[model samples]
Target: MDKEQVKKLRAICRDISVLYVEDDISISAQLEKLLRKIFNNVEVEKNGLSGVQSYTKNRQDIVITDISMPVMDGIEMCKRIKLINSEQNILVTSAHNDAEYLVKLIDIGVDKFITKPIDMGSFLSNISKIAISIYREKRETVLESRIKAQQNLQKELLNGIIFPLAYFDEGEIVYANSSFKKQFFTEIDAGDFSRFRLGYLFENKKYVSMSNSELVQEISNSDDKTYLVMDVNKKIVKKYSISVTKFQNAKGCLLSFVNLNALNEEINRFSEQVDYFPKRESFSQALLEPKKSTKENYEIFCVGLKNTKGFIDKYGGAKMHSIFNSLAKSLKKEFSAEVQSKELSIYLFETNRYIFLVEKNLDNSAIDKRLSDFGKKYNYAFGSGLPLELSFIKENIKNTQSIGDILENTEGMLYTLSTI
Candidate 1:
């Protein structure tokens, strides 16, 4: 090879890794040093068996092996590697120049063979050709992997969007967001929709003016106008106006759907406010009422909701209501024995969090014990998901410190415990 050829091959080998297997200790050591100088990574094995084991554990880009070794010969090793990856790049070295053996090596998918008294010029030139091939193949592999990664990132971003969204390629659906999946094809794969046009989804439902081919062409052009389509979700049909945007570097477009009626219904739900959480507000307020016995200090302990929206999204409103109601009822019953009904309050704090307040007449130790007991009795499974960021901290509500200040400090403590 010329100086330029050698430099080019070395540059390619600089990023490639190699695995060398041989029984000759002196030969193996010499080749190891040579391979290390050229390739980015070099792994050496004394025998064929360990070589196979090493390759299985950590695959390299190129493999070079001797024809004979102890425990397992190179023939069997080559066969095993070929079975694993038929396209594996391999070079074999042997002293014998037998025709039958050379034919066998070719059959086992060996790329090149070097004689025992190797000619340095021939070795460098042939190996350079293999390196060039490997470099080109690696670029293709890297390109494909990056494309897949980009697609995965796009899917994640689409899922974060609040409304139903889908992507089409050649007028066939290839990707759908989580909202679209839940609303329509929860059990079906996005690829299954690829065989049919987007208009196929509208059959047996709301009538639209455009034909499948016409709609597909219109969407490809994406004039920034909304088109009415049937949101065929399970057996129910909801009228959704879809906006299309042509995607750069793609032969298709992104479709976003908005159901005006559904949005209005959601708005109505948020508008209606609860005057009180049935009896919860009164219970918390009753604790602030003056006690007939003595003027006493108060101790507050709290459990908070981390992501209120996320919790409701995962567990639903019914489960949220049921668990909060149950937890409040349990806390009241547990602490009522030691403290007066008027002194114990399970208050509904910010964003549906619960704060337990009790007058300091009872032992603080007793309150801590009950809280710890409930946490353990549930095997911490109560918090596998739910409230009880309750690492019950004692915050004093003195003359100067407001109840809000006390609860805020406790909320901070609970947040730390939840993270830990």
Candidate 2:
């Protein structure tokens, strides 16, 4: 064998960890030297019985044994090893290079037969083949493990949530979990999702009819971290919110569809503070105010709450708005369907400030109770006022530089009075 070929075979052998077995101690000793040069770790056995012991102890990568031994033959030893690991790689070395011997070895699961004084060239070639096969098998195992890890991570991310998440590639749906697949039409084949792009199901035709130039521009202008809000027309339901986010490490975007109706309802309750507090408003005053009348008008009522800072730290304002939106949806159920003349509204103002506006009949005490409950639930200090008139809406805005100035100098209710 050429020196380069020997060197390559030796490298493979070093990585393989092998066991060598022969009945003749002198022959086995000579073979051990050759094996040592090729493999960094090679264990040799004088007899088949001893070979099985070495093989079991080291659990070597591959085994090579002579068939004619004193106590145990190669076939019997091979069968024992195979019973432990059926896919074991084995080679039989024999002086009798007959077809009958080769057939028998093959039946006993011998990977290859090396006869007589082994040809160094043939030995090198056969070892290379076996090395490649084992490497491929191990590689497949690692790849499968990685895929399973990714699937588990996806499951954990979406746990306890009912939203549908899907993945697509090159204008076709490649894979989707059970939740995501169920969001679309039932009994869909891969071919169906592939044929239909995301735009097919959206009510807005603009998304479907966009030109390639427009698409490119949108992608360029889009924030790498942003999501697309899609309105889906479901078979059973009319519409839902579909959030599409492109994976930073992968091709194609991941789409998560959440029912918008459900979200809206949540927002209403959170904004109205009906989620955590009872809706029964035990106001000291009778509900005698006229039903809200419609005259194009707007109002802004400032509410104060010592944020989580305990009058020292700031409340989580932006996040609070998010939660408030959820609360408002739950609160809407408190109102009758006919009570639509004047609607309750909520907004997050600058810093720890909040603005609320609703019909006058909503007792001030009821609003205070809700605000107090919110403060206690979240553990913060807060204060609120009655709804303001149309003329004073702008002044009551939290960030209005004048708002601080007005509150700093004025008394209750008077602080929000209109200058106009």
Candidate 3:
């Protein structure tokens, strides 16, 4: 390997703890010095017996052993270690170059090998590769454990509550409580939610069946952010009192639901608390109806964020909201202060989507320059350095009476201006 790669690998080795077993005093002493320089902790054992004992106590990140030893051989020690932890990472150094003996070590699940009379360079490179692999595997194990803990906590909270609830993350359903899951999903679709569809809840009857995106869009657009779904299982059509929460900490909203037959105080209490999703009806109305006295036309800029999942994963949900709010405020400031003879009205269509309306007097070139400038300034908004991309689509309603005509005549759908 190159020097740069070896240097990087050596950095990774700082986190790794090692157990080295060698019968020869000279070899063990030399190797231990080199290993101690890179590895955080190095435990040296004279023979396989002591190695096994030390491993039982420490369970180090890596185990390096000599094949031939006094009390027990490296193969035997590996077999016992495998019994203790099946996923243990073991590297064997062997002078004996027999194919059958190597096959035996492979069968015992030895991860790597360095032949006798070790080239110090090759040895360091191999150990570095194994070190990185072990590090990544352990990191994944920790991440999965954290995710499970969060899910368990959510499940406990959801199960205790009487109401059935499902939550969304950026217009996509991430989780639903047990009550919601049991009521909605079938036995076949229990563990695997890849084929999860809201339409499956009521197959035969259809009131207003929409995709996750469509549902979220409706919630964002309407003043009454509640969806009244019917429980078709009962003889009497039971109406559900639904409300989308204004929980600001999260990127998505909590969908609170209760039966209409429940106490008036409970429904009203929920409505009072979570009813903060304001209706963005002005833009939609502007699309259809024109101001008769002025007869003004608007230039439409349809904007969206690209690869939002990766952005959210890196920066988190609250940061994602800050990004959107920051963009909205910047656009508002630009239109209100700088741009002359132009009025701007912006509507947050979805979590990562926006509709911008500016006076149609300015041509596409002017809008492009303004958007490009705004994008450049926004890139350096915070010292945190957010890699935010704004996908803009330009369509003018200059001579055309309606926005529909602009949509019909538009060539391109969207253009991503900024990049990470």
Candidate 4:
């Protein structure tokens, strides 16, 4: 090829990665230098079998092979390479310009047919055309892959077990998955599917006017997921974990939903189990002496929940109990037996008043925040006492003036056993 022609073909090759398969070692070696002048990376394989291996491993953008070789012939190797990479850019080179062999390569998606005694000029021109074709093909492949990825993601989102999903365009429901329909028993007519509200499925007229636009907008603006609980017919619907995604092709929003009601129910049951237990003071009489050990401290810190009746009423008996249970579990996980609880020995106590003993140097702020979260659920306040030794802590519970005083005058539900 002339210098200018070679330069142009070289630029095209620079934009591509190619593989050459030839049986003749001397020919392959000489062509390697010439290919390197035009292409940045060229892989040369001595036989058809090695060519297939090289293509599979390196993901070659262009493949050029002689018609005949040992161990595996060009036809069989091309078939194998196609099985590995159906979109491979292939050019078949052969001295026999016969119709049968040329047709065979064409059928296997070969891009160019060249006769060898190898005319460098014609060869370079053919490679330039193949390079442009390969670039266009690659662009198409990328577009198809992106589209497939989006479709797969949509399928996965709609397939969730715990989440009831919906997608909104403006304030109207644009799409909903099987779980949403199943939950609502919604029979969506062709017209109803276009612009419908969540209230369409329920008997009551409560959520009919609730605007979904703001919710969708929130999801679009934030990168992380958001969650909230909405009341439906006076029943707390639990936490609805939501994610909003906006699409570029059109001004539409994707909304994802997770029904946390079951989780809330579990939390409620756990809380009730923890709350209804016999007063810990009953266990105080059997207090065992702390055994010295290397593994863990033999101390206990108690946390008390005082005046939580309002909280129980507001958050529902079940949910309040769940919150308490969660707190108790968290405390136990962090402090273990270094924690204990006992009702006051003195009968001058109140309803729903107890002392909790905690035994760790855990961050008081974090513990307080966790307790505060519980209080928020019940719409009440909690108070914590300073930590103290388990012995001093158990004894102080006996000094409350009255049940009313214990219930009403306590600082919060959370008290430190270390300072009590």
Candidate 5:
């Protein structure tokens, strides 16, 4: 290799730690001197056995060994090292050009091979290439770990809060929280949320009366008390006191919902005690108001009970209700009151459909494992080994569309699981 190429090789190998094994004292000394100049740490062993011992004590980034040795050969030592770490990079040096020996070394996962009386140029090029490969692998591993940690942190933040909220942009609903999904989007599929429009959600004629541009202008001009009147399942007209604020650096707006009844109750309490309170305006302003989106993350788990009608028919209404209550109690115990508290709710929809809304900071795998175990133990509640199956769907509360869309999606998934 040229001087510039040798310099580049030395730079690449500078930080790498090496383990070199050779039986000949003269050859070992010459190779050790060259290796010490290029590598940060160079460990030399007289035999394969000592090489394995040193490698076990402190694993090096690269291992270069001779095929012929006493006690243990290079092939045997490399085999042992591969068992320790399958990804360990090893380069073999051998005098014999025997096909069987070369095949054995390849079978043991040797990274590269160098001939006896090693050519300096070839050896430097191979080692440098291996070092670069190791560097890339390390960088990728670190990047993957960092991404995983960030995702986990987002999930944790989402699980900590309980409220129904949604974000809207350009007349479209972009995100909804767990409470919003359970309350409104209980029967819609999650993927279909992208197509759902914000205008179709409001039932109040006054709010839906204006054009999209006119409505956006009205909302942007003034921060007023607006209500979202939703015709939930075409059966009930549920009203929520909604507040809109422009999302920073974005063209869209954030819409938060506060239960009308809850807000009214707070207002009524404040009115009655107005005489005793000094900061009446501030206190009332803060009472039951919609919060700014923290973009929290949470996993939504839909728990469905199979064969509910048959179980109810055989066990009676009172017995079925008792079993459901018992199941809810068991679930609450497993998920803990501290994490969920009032957030864990069991809603009985239709005749045989039961959906449990659990809001907590848990990854899908952990939640699935716990529910699987819960299913095994809770099935006996039906008196006759009743078949209980559970399916879960996770939603990043920050990326949800509408509550109605979420409900529709969750119900659809439950229906598929029940049929299966």
Candidate 6:
């Protein structure tokens, strides 16, 4: 072999340990030197019995042995090794070219064979091949271990998520998280998830009317955004927000659900309060009053209570109404002067919705940051141990459009944010 070939062969064999059994002292000495040069560890045994003992103490990557030995022949030792580990790689060296002996070695699962008065060239070549196979096997084992670890981490992350979630492969339900199983399959036997389809969870006929293929096609062809509302039948109907996203390769998709029935009921109560409040006409008049200059800029904000019904249910509507009135009073106290100065105006649309018209010259980003911070502060201070979150959607009012157009665009933006 060329020097470069020898160098590469040694590099491949460097990490491997070898066990060699030979009764002849001269041959054993020569082979042991060569093996020590190529491998990190070399073990020599004068008999097959000693060889098997050495291997049992510390297994080697490769085993080479002569069939003719004084104690416990190579065949018998190899048979015992095979019983311990069927995948052990063994190389047999023998002086006899007897067909039966060679056949027996092969039956015992010897990896390679070399005849007596071994050819150095063939021996080196076989060693190189075996070394390469060992390296590949080690790599495959490491890769498999890494893959298993990643799978375990993914499973843990999925289980830790709070939302009910499911994964679909093409049209079939491949997996569901613990939350999903508990929420949707409580009465059904576990592992019977295969009986359910993704469409069966939705309330509207829109999803149920389409086949799985059709649904997949629709989701794939569209903007890839999720559907917002889902209905579930328990003792009573419940509403949830559903979010779906396709896998990167387009082979699968994941769905998650967030129950929003409490929030919906709160909004419904706010709608009912509309009949009791008579501030609509005054708020409209205030908003419709002409500005100082037609060239002046302004920003419009549409705000609504998030999950207000849940808050009211937990802390009665009378208390929630008082909180809302207090919030409105606070806003008026802070901004009524600005409204008089043509810099800002706050209008109440319904019990839950408010429109803020502010001077357009204000930095949009700064306003957003301020409002977000203010929302957090207000919720913490006056939320009565409930979240009492709020949603604020904004748009620029560039023209002297009618109140109808302004309200329409504001509601459109709110709807968009709700879906998101």
- What lDDT tens digits, residue by residue, belong to model 6 across residues 231-323? 332434456666567767678788777767666656765664443333546655655666623666578777666767777788777677767
lDDT of 2 by residue, 129-194 (tens): 887777677778889999999988876776445676666665566666666655553444444765
lDDT to native, each model: 0.68, 0.58, 0.69, 0.59, 0.67, 0.74
Q: In model 4, where do residues sit more than 4 Å from their true spots?
A: 1-17, 38-40, 56-59, 70-72, 83-86, 107-111, 136-165, 168-174, 177-199, 202-322, 325-420
Worst window of 10 by summed lDDT in candidate 3:
411-420
Pick the winner on lDDT between candidates 2 and 6: 6
Off by over 4 Å in 3: 1-10, 154-163, 167-175, 178-239, 243-255, 258-263, 266-420
Candidates in descending lDDT order: 6, 3, 1, 5, 4, 2
Quote each prediction's TM-score. Answer: 0.58, 0.48, 0.48, 0.45, 0.47, 0.58
Which lDDT tens digits does candidate 3 get at residues 47-125?
8899999999999999999999999989999999999998988888989999988999899888589998888888887
**Model 5 segments more than 4 A misplaced:** 1-15, 165-420
As a TM-score, model 1 comes out at 0.58
Top candidate on lDDT is: 6
The digit string of per-residue lDDT tens for model 1 on 199-277 reads: 5455433324555446766655755544444454656567666677776777877777887667776565334323222
The alpha-carbon RMSD values of the candidates against the true structure, listed in the order shown, are 9.4, 15.0, 19.3, 14.4, 21.2, 13.1
Screening candidate 6 with a backbone cut-off below 3 angstroms (N, C-alpha, C), the clashing residue pairs are 266-309
**Overall local distance difference test of candidate 1:** 0.68
Worst 10 residues of 5 by lDDT: 275-284
lDDT comparison, 1 vs 6, better candidate? 6
- Alpha carbon lDDT at 149, candidate 2: 97
Going through the candidates in the order shown, the clash numbers are: 0, 21, 0, 37, 18, 1
Off by over 4 Å in 2: 1-7, 56-58, 151-162, 167-174, 178-238, 242-258, 262-420
